[model samples]
Target: MDSRNLIRHKTQVVCIGAGPAGLTASYKLCQNQIPVVILETNPIYVGGISRTVNYKGYLFDIGGHRFFSKSQAVEDFWTEILGDEMLTRPRKSRIFYKNKFFDYPLKAMQALLNLGILESILCVASYIESKLFPPKEIRSFEDWVCKNFGKRLYSIFFKTYTEKVWGMSCDEISADWASQRIKGLSLSKAIINSLISPNANQDRAKVTKSLINSFRYPRKGPGQMWEVTAERIKEMGGKLFMGTHVC
Candidate 1:
């Protein structure tokens, strides 16, 4: 290709990624009559962590994407993309401990049934002890979790999973990572939330993404939403350059 023919075109907004963040921004820009260009490092696909992968006509989520957010506009934007193709799904997950299964989001009654009276009593005592005397120096993930949920619960629920994911002892991992990734709810908050009905505020701003029970998902896969979003952007006079890798 001649350098002269490869003259760079000008754009008002240059989106560096074609993932959810970049694509969403571009869609809004195009909606408001602004010109934009998208640059994605991946040769194909769009949703980023929320993207779905296809194998021989079978689609699978690369990372589970529960399209839940505190922002009504964000939720609306997702609905605008998929419309009826979106499905609101109830969450169902479980915790495995000592050959026992406990429902997640933890119904207190279920936990009591699963953990038994003696174990439950010990867990409560541990929680009270942690509350009364938090570890003096809170540095590691273990320290943080034990201080909040208690040593017993941490050992059963957190320690194993944390080690498995990071392949490091909890004492080695920093507490800051917990603050950044696991915000909104704590062990105390989870217990309280389970005991009561959702607050009647009805404000989307108050909703926490992590604790929400229901979320929207594309009927086919998350990739379908992005595919349609890209098409709409093109129809609105936005340029989509596929198979183009940029640093």
Candidate 2:
């Protein structure tokens, strides 16, 4: 690449990518009256994984992007960005395995019944064994999950889905990833919650992200969020360079 052909800009801060986090950073910098420049490789889209694809007047998201958060600040930020345009929708997730539908967050009675009496007994024994004698080293996602939910339950509920989504075996993935995603969730807690408050409020701060029963989303798709945020950033004097790559 020729030096003269390169585009140059002066800014106190430079943000790479126009995803949710990057755009949020730029928006905040602009709010504080700081000079910031954002560089996004994709010229046509801004939300990265959250981007909405338009095909012949139809809109679709790359993946399901739910707007549920336990943090008040996160909720406030989304409301600030797209007020009145967000829709509250019930969360319905289920796993199809062995020709049976299993609820996510695992309803104890339901899951046990679905797995059958013999399998359920084995699962309970496995869970008790894990509680009694856990693996000394917690290194990978497999270790973390097995320790928390037992090998039988982990294999049934988590292993295949996690590998399919992330394209990695449980042993290959770091424990940190599991810790972050499955934090504050345990088999015991889930069972107790299922029995007591089966339909807990999704907005409650105590509700974990994975267990939320409802969430908010933009009318057009999640991309609308970044698009609006980008406009707001520009309105506040922040610069955005699309179709640009940082070398």
Candidate 3:
């Protein structure tokens, strides 16, 4: 690489990666009339994981995203970009257990129907047992979850998937991960809440970041939002160089 042959340019801000954070920062900086350059490693896409993948005639999300943001500014940003193009999608996640699908967020009726009377009884008994004689030392994710949710529920709900995700025994993962992720959520609380309000997440205050009944998404896909945002950035005289790496 010759020094004179190498192209050089100057900007007030040089953003790395055109992911959500990077793109948002560049958009804001350019809006303030500050010169900015965005370097996106991806050659063609803008949204990173949130980018929509299109085939011959099919459209799919690379990694599914729900357009519900805890921040008002984010919500406003989405609205400003897509507006009526956004559609509200209901959450309906299911997990496979014992070769059967179990409704996520624990649908009381579905769990009872799927697990059967005998297994349900055993699970309830196990919950009672855990409460009566919880592990004295709750250091691991397994211990904390077992104490709060019972061994039977933990084995059925959290065990296999957790191991698959982290590639470690339940005891190996830190309890802090569980505590931080599902602080207010517990098996008993979920059961009780279901009996009261089947879809317990009407209020965001009581809901975890992962738990949302419904969320807005662009009609085309999440990529639409970012594409529009990128266009806005370019219109504002922001320099965007896709397929460019920071090295």
Q: For candidate 2, write residues 37-87 as lDDT tens digits.
A: 899999788998899989998998988788987788999999999999999
lDDT of 3 at 15: 89
Worst 10-residue stretch by lDDT in candidate 3? Answer: 2-11
**TM-scores across all candidates?**
0.73, 0.86, 0.74
Compared with the true structure, what per-residue lDDT tens digits does model 1 show for residues 77-169?
888888999999987667787788876544455675688999988887998899999999989899888887789988877788779756789
Q: Which has the better lDDT: candidate 1, or candidate 3?
A: 3
Worst 10 residues of 2 by lDDT: 2-11
- Residue-pair clashes per candidate, as listed? 0, 0, 0
Candidate 1 vs. truth: CA RMSD? 6.4
Error of 2 at 80 (Å): 0.7
Clashes of 3: 0
Error of 2 at 81 (Å): 0.6
State the lDDT at 238 in candidate 2. Answer: 88
